[model samples]
Target chain A: MRITSQTTSDGVSEHLFTLDDIPGVIWSPSEGTAGRPLVLLGHGGGQHKKAEGLVARAHRYVKDCGFAVAAIDAPGHGDRPKVERHERLVADIRQRVTQGEALGSHIARYNVALAEQAVPEWQATLDALRELDHVGGPVGYWGASMGGAIGVPLVAAEPRITAAVLGLTGHESLTEAARRITVPVEFLLQWDDEMVPRDAGLALFDAFASREKTLHANPGRHAGVPAFELDSSARFFARHLLEDGGPAEVEESSARLDRS
Target chain B: MRITSQTTSDGVSEHLFTLDDIPGVIWSPSEGTAGRPLVLLGHGGGQHKKAEGLVARAHRYVKDCGFAVAAIDAPGHGDRPKVERHERLVADIRQRVTQGEALGSHIARYNVALAEQAVPEWQATLDALRELDHVGGPVGYWGASMGGAIGVPLVAAEPRITAAVLGLTGHESLTEAARRITVPVEFLLQWDDEMVPRDAGLALFDAFASREKTLHANPGRHAGVPAFELDSSARFFARHLLEDGGPAEVEESSARLDRS
Candidate 1:
């Protein structure tokens, strides 16, 4: 499943790398030939390589911030072989449950399995980025919704990610996955969003193992993502990936205000 | 533009009324020939007539439980005529903003316009539903996400609607369209969901001048509406639409609490 790297006429380098022998796409800036920091991007449900808006944003990050980005289509979505339609996937789960499968655990397992298969793809993309001369060292991750779900497991299992930003997604463990992630994470929450419950998101934030985590709440619906928030995400990535270790001095000073 | 209704099949005793005025297929159960409550059902963004999972669940209060249902598609989605490609739609907003249209106001207008166009279709659908002996009486409204946004304007503009149930949709008063809505409202919020911010949702809830209002907070993400919550929505709709004079017992309790 290793994807071979190819250079386009535009001089942008592309590659298919395999992890767990699973295939994934890697994109690097044309100017950056040397090693640089990599940012792994994961698409949400029913999305493919170029389908995610965040992926395009990730490209901007690579160009403006001098980082490489890698993204992969998940199982039953995008370029990945479609084993079943979304309805069929749900039906299969239902059938299995009717046949005695533990419904709750099965749902969790299904998500984990889907995430596991894509892990190698993420790893391979990371490997390709690491090989680049412009790539610094290690990598970061950014995901939205379903991609946010995968980012949790990816960061938890892979220590290579230096920082993570999860937008419009949260869970309490795999029961609510947000709680399981130990990394320095930033979560973007939508208030009146119907797709995901706010309390579940807050629970995930509460469960995060990192003391440095931050939460930003914005106004918008399921499809709304304000431009300023995107800027905030960029700032978070820059702070964690490019700046020196520990919270900025201002943040530290504010952190000490609870002494009273 | 008003659309007339016609009967499709007569021999079966239950006449099927059809309205070709709207962009998508909409149907109503022929139960009442006269004096039945009119219920309008709105589908979320990127959804069509049947709205199987989420929309269907929301529509239960109007359909299986009691109220007559009228379903319509949103703009550039479902059976509606395509206005622009997905990327183009987003790009158009950006273009408009660059030309001096305030970003928030423009988005609200775009959403309201989409809903307004669909209203004629809904009116036509209601006309068709009225053709049946089973449908009569005051209209009630129900919608989730984008549907909620549309319902807000529709209920405000149309005095025919007696009540409404809006779920999982809200934003700041950045748009004038949002400011016009005044209705008996119920808001469902997810604290951690990233698609919409809770603060923005709360602000919208506060903006409503409705004497009757309810807010529910749960744990979930933009895509994670658990089965239990779906059932709660059914109850919510039933309380407003199906109950004898709008759940007298609960209202009394609420009133008592208010006085206390």
Candidate 2:
């Protein structure tokens, strides 16, 4: 692992690094480098580690929860060399989108291939991230769409992840992996998502064996998830990752309506 | 309107009152009786305004948000006299539960009848409550199951309600009312609810015309909504009601991932 660059802004310190050939970045509170929660972010397809949305979310988690956040480029995403096969797949998907054809099977097959390679990369990244002084507490994973496609498999394989907020891409290929995950999960589904069928999303949510999983469905296309969900996800991570003096204490009420 | 009794406990003042023939209760912060948000809770069937769950929720809203919370007995519930027709309906529903027969249509029919009588009483109660100093700000409604049955119509008919958190019971009968509601809504759906069909619940969420409606579905029976949802709803109300110096400002962000 090597740190290539570093900068500080708005009380958050950003560090860019590479483990072997995998390019990644980590965000933390500049002043406090002690033990704090760490959140790993997986960017969507065609997006890199510091995608606008992921950076914003990382900043919020750092500012609101005082947690360290990190993101890494996928196998052929961001600064990595593009694979010819993935390039062909992307072109085919764009063609299919123009033709208005069903994308479920095609995307599922492609994501399965991506997950096989990316999961191990993420595992290695976690191994290196834990060596840092600021990142030693519980861990969380936040990713959607292709990120979710990778996350479903990673969270299932990695015991270090205690909670996750994953969604957008749900396929039969990932069902088995989702079933193996027992951590608290908050899944997102766009009601009118054009790429992924609605039933497929609901079915994936059902496949999670976690006793505590919540599904948040909103009305919009694939990239149109409302901004409020960011806040909701922050609270979810705070509940699971932070052990003391956090927002988790306020939710321990026994107030439930009588089911008549 | 008359206040028949009053008590203070845990920093919340609970007042039992009657508006004409309708029995009701209101909860508020004991010290500050000035302008604040008000939330109206509708209890489930066979339960009353002061149901244990409703009181707990009222106390949280008052203590946490410094807001007034109110709940009124439906026509045939709480301290009100029972209607013979409603009595027959209750017996029939209990019988169906024993026989394990389908209860969707039966409950919808009964709820439609109840809404007709309850909506006007709720409107009158709102009209009376607004006269109180602490209850003049934006209003929100929280109800599910039978409460949702009544809330769908009440929120649709009353223009004063700016936001709502409703779910648990969904049928074709409430479709039109849901379509008419244009305010922000947070809907709940139980994934394994025995009473309400999952499709019907999804359809109800689809029928909402609000530009900012969200659906939060979880794994459980009809009454198994997770406790975290109560805290989530409190934040939803605070966002829509309190215009300044609240938790709403934290959600404003422009972070989003680019979809490939």
Candidate 3:
């Protein structure tokens, strides 16, 4: 891992770096972070690692929970070079959007492809992030829409993530992955989401095998998730990640951290 | 209203009382409650004012938020004399339950009748409670199942109530009343509810005219609402009832309190 730039603002240290060719960023308290928990954020389609909402949420997680947070550009998002296949997929989705046709199948296909690559990238990034002195503790993932599309499979494949806040995208393509997940989950759904049908969202929430999953639904379109959810998310993460807090297994796992 | 008995325990003062023919109970901080907020809990069917769940929740509200809470026996329920009509309704419902027949229509009819008598009794109780030195403040309501059934109409009819936590019972009978309510609401739904159909619950939540409504859905049967919901309810009431706490109008209305 190579640190490209570092800056501190509002008591949070932002570090931009690259691992091989994958660009990513990590945020922590400006003061020394000895053993804070970590949260990984995945941005939506057409959004980058530092999307405005992602950055605000990162700040909240850092300040409210004293947790280190990180985000990385997906294979064709942010500063990453767009492959021909991804370009074609985006073009197809955009055309469908303009034609007022359903985007579920196309979006799901694109998301599946991204997850195939992004999951491995996230795994590698977690391996490297854990090696850092400031970012080594129980981990959580927060993502929605395309982020959720990718996250369903990633969380299924990654054992390091103990909990996740995922929703806003739903497809049969992701059902198997969702069923395999056993960690606690807080899933958000927009009741009137234009892109995702309400039944599909409800069905996806039903697919989660996690014994401690919750669904928070609100009245809005695809992009109008209520602000109070941020507060709820902060609490959810705190309940699962912080030492002397959350699940006993989390604290037990922290005790087992090798931190070598 | 006449106070029949009063006891103090666990930092909460419990008072048993009667207004006319109505029997009820009130809970508040054992210490003098000067201007704390108030919450009204409506009990479920086959249960009374001092039902185990209602008493537990009342203590929580008093201890956690320093709020006064109250509950009343609905007509033909809990220390109230059962009339021939109520007996016939109960017999019908019991038979339906035994035969595995749908009880939606029968239950809705029974709830509608109870609400008519219950709403007036509640308003009278509120009027009397607010006259006490420790019980005058902004008002909220919490009830589910039959409590929700009666509560839908009561909250709709009572302008003094500014927010509510209601769910677990859904039917067309309550649709009109639900639409008339504009207060902030937190609606709960058990995904696999045995009594209420999923669509009916979703429809009722959708019928609420409150601009700020949230739906918390979990995978469980009707009687399996998770315990964390109690904590969430306390925060919801706190946000809407306390001075400088919730909606602007609630505070404005409190300032308008004559206290005569």
Stronger candidate by lDDT (2 vs 3): 2
In model 2, the runs with Cα more than 4 Å from the true position are A245-260, B245-260
Looking at model 3 chain A, report the run of 10 residues with the lowest lDDT sum: A251-260
The alpha-carbon lDDT assigned to residue A152 of candidate 2 equals 99
Task: Please give the distance, in angstroms, between residue B171's alpha carbon in candidate 1 and its true position after superposition.
Answer: 20
> Candidate 1 local accuracy as lDDT?
0.58
| CAPRI accuracy category, model 3 | acceptable
lDDT of 3: 0.87
TM-score of every candidate relative to the true structure: 0.44, 0.94, 0.91
Tens-digit per-residue lDDT, B1-260, candidate 3: 89999999877899999999999999998886486778999999999999899999998788656799999998898999997787899899999899999988898888888888889889999999999899778999999999999889989999999999999989999999999999999999998898889889999999999988999988889999988788678767877787655422222232222110
Candidate 2 whole-model C-alpha lDDT, 0 to 1:
0.88
Best candidate, lDDT-wise? 2
Encode model 1's per-residue lDDT on B1-260: one tens digit a residue.
23334342211111222345354332344333455565677877677755676335524443434445556566676655677544365577779767866444445556666766766656656556666555666667777677877776666666666667765666653224445655556566565555556666666665665655545444566555444344344445545554453332322322332233
Best by TM-score: 2
List runs of model 3 lying over 4 Å from the truth. A246-260, B246-260
A1-260 per-residue lDDT for model 3 (tens digits): 99999999887899999998999999998886577789999999999999999999998777656789999998988999997898899999999999999988898899988898999999999999998999878999999999999899999999999999999998899999999999989999998899889988988999999988888999999999988788678768878888655422222322222110
What order do you get sorting by lDDT, best first? 2, 3, 1
Candidate 2, residues A129-203, lDDT tens digits: the string is 999999999999999999999999999999999999999988889899999999999999999998899999999
Looking at candidate 1, what is the lDDT of residue B195?
Answer: 54
